[model samples]
Target: MAKAIQKITLDRSEDIPFDKLELSQKNVRNIKAGVSIEDLANDIALRGLLMSLNVRPVLGDNDEETGRYEVPAGGRRYRALELLIKQKRMAKTEPIPCIVKRGASTSVEDDSLAENVHRLQLHPLDQFRAFQTLHLQGLGEEEMAARYFVSVSTVRQRLRLASVSPRLLDLYANDEMKLEQVMAFSITNDHVRQEQVWDTVSRSHVREPYYIRRLLTEAAVRAADRRAVYVGVEAYEAAGGVVMRDLFEQDQGGWLQDPALLEQLVFEKLKTDAEALKAEEGWKWVDAAIDFPYGHASGLRRFYGERTELSADELARYDEVKAQYDKLDADYAKAEDYSEETETRLEELGNELDRLNDRPHVFDLEEVARGGVFVSLDASGELKIERGFVRPEDEPAGEVDDADDGDNDGNVGVATSVTGGISVNGKPVAVETQEEEDDKIRPLSDRVIEDLTAARTIALRNALASDPIMAFVAALHAFVLKTFFLYGSDSCLEVTMQSAKFGQTQGLGDTVGAKEIEQRHEAWGHDLPKTPAELWDYLVALDEASRQALFAHCVSLSLNAVVQPWNRRPAAIAHAEQLARSIGFDMVDAGWTPTVDNYLGRVTKAHILQAVREAKGEQSAQLIDHLKKPDMAREAARLLEGSGWLPEPLRLAVDETPAVQSNDDAAELVGDNVVEGADADLPAFLAEDADSEDAASEGAEVEEHRHLDPAE
Candidate 1:
């Protein structure tokens, strides 16, 4: 039959008539508008229409109320055109090309159903969307399936896919997963399982459709199981599937999932089965020889008579097969040529051999029984035979006559014996005896004692040395005790005299009084005795005593130095005098000359003198003369400059002294020999030197220059 062709001119909206359209309402399914009308309009503007619209002729006469006809399948296209027309991009009168079917013989529903069932093949997702649209429109699954020429199960599966969580549907729509993957994931009807499938599929880089489906399937199953999901090649074997040796050897996911556990379980089962097999069969040897002409039939055999009943032809055939296997086994046994394939084949052959050898063979009891085999008659009078070169039944059994005679020596007997000495009724009896030998004893040597004593000495020294105050007190006690023992009641005076001498030597003088010295001596010496042995004990204590005294004296000196004002130099001198008096010594005898005291006094006086001289703008000749000495000039210059005595010019001159020397011999002579001249010119030079020196000294002052007295 020639196909009917028709040309159609229809209103843009009415051109694709719903009545003549072949796509069923069920087939029209859900007209899911994924994109907005704006997007469709844009797509139409750029690409025009890629698909032809389905339409049907208007029934009876055209509508009189409206000038346009209704659309069928091209609703989206019609809307797009309407947008373009409103935007003035397309003419309102423009005619859209479409195919039309006559409505006289076909109902709108029948045409729609035929178009969806026979003409169009929709994508799984699109089909799902279509089913949803029909379902929402109140069409049943069976009716939709019948109308669309699809199975009810197919329609239901599609509907289920559509009903899947939106999160999972998005994965399908975005091409993150395939419809089949989504379909497999939909099996569980669990959102968590679907999500897991989506997650597994999306994260994987599997571009192949098969792998994506497989991964999704496995992930869904695992999500359902809620256990550690093993996938890939390892899963096959772990699930008890038989795998080829080569396949097993490969690093497939099946074995890789948990190799240790799988291998252990497999080998343990194999071992258990092998042990059980071994126990069921008594030990027996089968001829392993391979015949040359008859292949494996060349070796000796010791089987029972009944096994020998097989024809020679049957044996020869067996030998031929066995020989071929032997050759293969020999080739495999070569180390360089050995491989998993060969090993697997060898294992199979060995297993077969084991099975064959396990078969039972009949034997004559009378002939075997005379050759060390045992024959027994049971209560039922049935004869039983055991065959072997060595019969266990013929071996002699051991006997024990008495439990006490463990060795079973017929003639030997045991007798009781006593230790130390044997006695009967208090009378000594003859007994075996051994002699005792003497061993020499030695005493500890002097060297060992010396080492121990040295260790003790070091411990004591460390304890005494820990604190200087303790050492000082120990020294005082020792001195007092030694004096007391040597001179009796005169020790107090003697100790006072020594303290005085010590104070004077340190220049502390009379600040430390005799009463304080006596009190300190008594406090430290009270624990000591007046005997020679006590003197030794006092000496031991002296180290700490002396340390205490020295520390005390140093503290007193520091206090005096800090407390005395800059103008009170004689205060320290007087304080030293007091210390000397307390220790029962004259300050002068302890190296405190009047000059030394005066020098210290001058240190305080000089600071004031320096400031006064600086304020007057006139240097003191006495001070300047004292500072001019080689050792004192640098220090004096520092103090003078620090005090603002010299003006900017002299200060600059002093600073430029090095450069002046570098200029020439005369310049050198001027800087080196001009001090006296500089001093002489002080009235004019001091002003300039002071200003320049002040600017030069702006940042950090030299610490050495801040103090006027060098002793300070």
Candidate 2:
């Protein structure tokens, strides 16, 4: 039925029985009663009542209180308004706007029962109270629903919610517990057991309703004593207790002292078990906790076997030793800072020594001389060789007679003894020596020459390889000659010849080749000899191209290995000298040794002279004449003769000859009556000339007058 609007005043002083209210306590389910009363009070004070109370009239026993009404809803709003009234912000005389159901003659007991059961839903605690009341009245679920106008299931749920222990119910009331948790709590009929579960949950800070449900379900499955122990263990671990192996043994035997202490002992035991398991299996505590919570205790007992108790004295001594060791470690760490500079210097020195050791050995003349053979210079300036027993003519010529003496020689000649051996350097040396002795008697000069040849060959090969043009030239030289210095007896001559070949080949007979040669000479001074030997030396000393070519070749070779393109010019002679040097020949200058700047200037001057000749031929005679004209003072008539404004014939005539003045007595041409010849046109010409002279004089006078006027 639609609510009838009514102006109803709430009696602040009236003590209306809460039971008489039409609000249903069973329906008063927890709804996160948002915003505390204090907050709501503030909201009410700021904003007046926003909603009216829904109520129905309560009939007295014999119509004595037929007009009395009870609120069906808006209890919260009614209380807020009542507070406003008490605070005198709203007058008591002002009636509160209300929605009423008229002629609803329901008894207060029936209304109270209806309010508690049907009109207003109650909190779980309130529902529990109502359910107990109705249950005490011996009302069945169906009868109670009929009285409250609700479903039987609804009554059962409320009754179940009510059956939860007061401690657990308080969790619901405070909004700490959820309906699902209350339902889960209602699974068991024992309040003592529920309280124990609640205590476990509260201690463990396991506020999740789902976890609570799971715990209840788990408790239902396990034995009560085991469940209690598990709860204690969970609570103990939650409280930061470390359960040991001994605690588990005590727990299994039912020797738990205090319930809380049992939790504490189990937690303590867990820590000891964690340490033991970590030591034996390398399992972390968290991993162990995940693997086995209760079963871990059994594993711990089996693993530990028996606890090895440590005396206080032993622990103290161990702690002291650990402290001293830690202090020493800290001191050592501090000492590391002090030695860091020395260590760094030592490391740098060690690296420097290693680098120095890695370098090639320096040339050792003393060591070369110590091998019985000595280095000597020949008359031709070439290195010479002498055996240990031989002496050169320059060495004071060791006494020949003494060398032949029988006492000095090993062999003795008794009239027919062997006397066929030659005496060398004061020693009698056998001509036909043993193969081993002969092999050991190599000349020092020959060895020195051999070593020098090897070193030169290695250095040249390295230099050639480092420079692409030089390498190409070297290879080409070796290819053409079919004999490298390293392979020939005259290695030095072969090397010199090879270098000459490179120079000749690189200076190819072409303009581009010439330019490249010129450029090379420009960069490297032209004073460098154009000989093959000089070119080879130049290439060897020219480290710039070598380093660049080395880098380029390295990169190109690396890239080519992956991307094989056949067109790549791996050994291109970019410069003419490179090709010339590579060909192992001299760059013959053709009797023309032009420096770069000189050659360029000569070519430029030739071009400029050719252009001037061409311009002189192509230009007009007048333009050329104008060019030839001197200063204005020197050739004032030439300017007038060549002026483009004049007729072509007149200009040509005036320019061809000098202008001549006519005498006054020669002819009085026109009004002046002057005539030089009896020519009929001459008079007109003179007159025109006289008139032109007069006009010129007048114009000059006008200009002078303007100037004088300015001065004045």
Best by TM-score: 1
lDDT of 1 by residue, 496-565 (tens): 3221111111112122232243334334443344344666656566676564654554332122211111
lDDT for position 133 in model 1:
93
Model 1 misplaced regions, further than 4 Å: 1-123, 126-166, 174-197, 200-272, 283-310, 313-712
Question: How does each model score on TM-score?
Answer: 0.20, 0.18
Clashes of each: 68, 56
What's the CA error at residue 141 for candidate 2, in Å? 0.9
Whose lDDT is greatest here? 1
Poorest 10 consecutive residues by lDDT, candidate 2: 293-302
Q: Which RMSD does model 1 reach against the true structure?
A: 42.0
